[model samples]
Target: MTRPTHLRIHQFAGLQPGPRLLVTSAVHGNEVHGTKAMAEIARQLDAGQLTLRRGTLTFVPIVNPLAHQLDRREGDRNLNRNLRPPVIAQDFEDRIARVLCPLIAQHDGILDLHSFQSAGQAFAMIGPRNNTGELEPFAQEATESALAGRLGVSRIVEGWLSTYALGLQRRQQRQSDGSRRAQLISDPHYGVGTTEYMRSTGGWAITLECGQHLDPNGPEVARLAILRTLVFLGMLDDAAVEPHRPAQPPEVLQLYDVIDREDMGDSFEHAWASFDAIKRGQQIGTRASGEAVLAPSEGRIVFPNVKSQPGTEWFYLARPSDRVLG
Candidate 1:
């Protein structure tokens, strides 16, 4: 089995006990903005400008260094999927995810870093609000009241990690004591599929999509998000946050399906950025054969593909609802 590797950094201020935060970045190596945000936050905090009112903070930047080094997805596959470990293949992402999930579970709170292919707006992701039952560790601040009051996101979306963890818990409950307990399942929040595995074990986690990939402003937005989280978790005082518009609900939805298109032979005409609405029966794209692909329902595009792989997502159409959000 391939052993997992990770990097960690910490900052502390004052004698009081505060919320412990695990801030991670670069699960997807291309998502460098989050890593930069981590550095920036560390710099500001260590400078003592952004003092921790009550908690410890840890950051793991460049979680998938090999993928970042290659500038390609892990082993030519998307690192965001299939995060089972014990390293049967001894590859990069698997080892990294295996190591990171446990570390995230150790903290009182977590904020994994990420970025999108298209232009993105910063937002806090609250996993489908209801199932905080299994992931009580992560859900300490996941209630609708806390999100609305602190993070300012009223609409709660189902997270891929929350779904997988809850499912495992239910399955394990059905199993006899003699049956082996199920191991963790990795998920989207971390570059590993196993974030869900940690969630199933009652861990806390959140994936923060800072902004557009490679955009000049991406890092700054990520940096701001981290600071905001610190404040929301009571790490910093309100003075750190500049007065801004409250975060509107993000269509509160689940990831009902992800349509992974195979190859560039299929072309999508026109621009379809994230949050752009699509109507039912609208022509979203076309195949090389000129066959039409239509929207199944009236919904908005969550993650559209300008860059994609053959047999991978060209983009995903998200149905805004609890049942479909995960």
Candidate 2:
């Protein structure tokens, strides 16, 4: 079978049949750590230094080559969002998605690697059990959750769609009076990224944010994550791999709200970083009209992007989730 010309897929098949795993990196052009890690993994496998004991493993080092060449988040638009079957390939990402989604659907597990703009510890974004739309028949929420825990990250995030929907609802609520509230859109079930699409196909998937985009540690994290996943899936012999201890049980965080830049006005009060702690009522930013943007509640700030466009997410607020599973 021929692969898409725009991207590359490095594949390895074992003698014994087993689960099929798809690991992708550089979905965003600028996040190159995962791409580098995948390259190294490919090299090791090619040289016979690493072996797949069972099943099939496919690695797409650069999912968005044009964006990677441009050194931007996307070629034309955010490829991670609005993942659905394309009626027509109208843009660069759309064309790629059309070709990529079908391959993703064939996998039993997926790991989409990424990095953030701000400095922070690595974490895995885990989807909620209830979010599995069509893929629920193939894998259950408990199975996906177990797979996420084995990724060697210290933090796991859930409620991604709920948080995004909350942001949209808040925006609509502000636009309307209490007597005439706008009707909120129904949940699409599928998210805008590779993981969501994979889950929708009944395959377990997780998005690993391997720290800051340019951090040296990012590549290492990505490398280890891949190795850990192989070991976790029993695709590799642990005795043959280097011995390493996994991180302490991860802390589960449930994102509840997101603040968009459009609602915040012109600029932030200060340069905010991801995972910054915010006290209730603290000034987080300033509106164009000189109004202060205060923290709605005491929680940690995540995904704070100072350069985000107006009407797009500026930052997210999250609290410790009571559901902690390893």
Candidate 3:
């Protein structure tokens, strides 16, 4: 089936001659914070309170509008996964990415905003394990610090999706040298699955997980997250904004791999915290063996199975993303 070219709605005209900042929200649909924040910021700019200064500002305020309406994780269809130019470019995410990426690249960096499930805390995902060198130019320390200020949390996950995407670009540059037709992963996916795809093509992108989905203030917090990202990317100066800082640093963790179970699916006991420790081979939960089930492996039970949809991950295990950083 063919997809629509422009699901065009309200166009912001020329916010700039070229995009200086690209703030996208709800790429996952259910995550609503970024959209609200972007809209509010747009309103402020219209009100003459905030300034765009030099470069343009672009926003895909509701990237996956269909999925956002449904409050689902993926688009009712999978528009995000296939981001390459030729293959069904009209699909939702692909169309938006096509329009969004080049515009974002016109600027210094991008601030792709996001939020997480209700159980999770707010943190910024910064990555590419080895690409902090490149990120240094894009995301200066003051900017990162300013982002930490707005997020109200100091926990920054290194080697994030965009970081790794830049890492892949570095690899491609080394191989072909000055060839734009280099062989590169279209959507740079780290072991972290869906989110990192934009990093490779979208210059510097970060997935800012802003608290729980159901929280009344999640949207507002998510908006601040985008501002912080802008500050870090140098689009916004630190003195212009005030970011709330969490006492001490946020405990950062590496996202290992998502875990899944078949029969009776993965489960856990009530009230276990996200970073809680578990013993090797300890029986954390069970599956219906029609008998006695067993624990699979050992690490610490990560993202844990909660009472929700069937296939939406039971749990995940991780050590840390920084431990391996060079």
- Candidate 1, 218-313: lDDT as tens digits: 787667667777777777897997633555534566655455454477776677777677898988888767888888888776678867754345
Better of 1 and 3 by TM-score: 1
Model 2 over residues 1-326: C-alpha lDDT tens digits? 23235678889999999889999998999998889999898898889888889999999899888888888897766778666667877667778888789999989989899999977889988777544353333345676677678766778888786677666655654544333112212223323589878877777888999999989999988898888888878998785455444557788888988877765356776777777788999998887878888998888889988778655678898888887574
- Model 1 misplaced regions, further than 4 Å: 1-8, 11-14, 73-76, 84-89, 132-141, 148-198, 243-251, 322-326
Question: Using TM-score as the measure, which candidate wins?
Answer: 2
lDDT score, candidate 2: 0.78
Scored by CA lDDT, what does every candidate get? 0.60, 0.78, 0.53
Clashes of 1: 25
lDDT of 1: 0.60
Winning candidate number (lDDT): 2
What local lDDT score does residue 241 receive in model 3, on the 0 to 100 scale?
67
Ranked by lDDT, the better of candidates 1 and 3 is: 1
lDDT of 3 at 292: 27
lDDT of 3 by residue, 1-326 (tens): 34334533223434345435566777678877778877887787789776655455667777776677677766534444444344555435655666655554454445666665536566666544323454323323333334444566555665333334444454434434332222223234323322344444434455676667776777777767666655554555675467556666565666554443434554554555454566666666655453323344444444464653332245555555444211
Taking every candidate in turn, the Cα RMSD to the unseen true structure, in Å, is 7.1, 5.0, 8.2
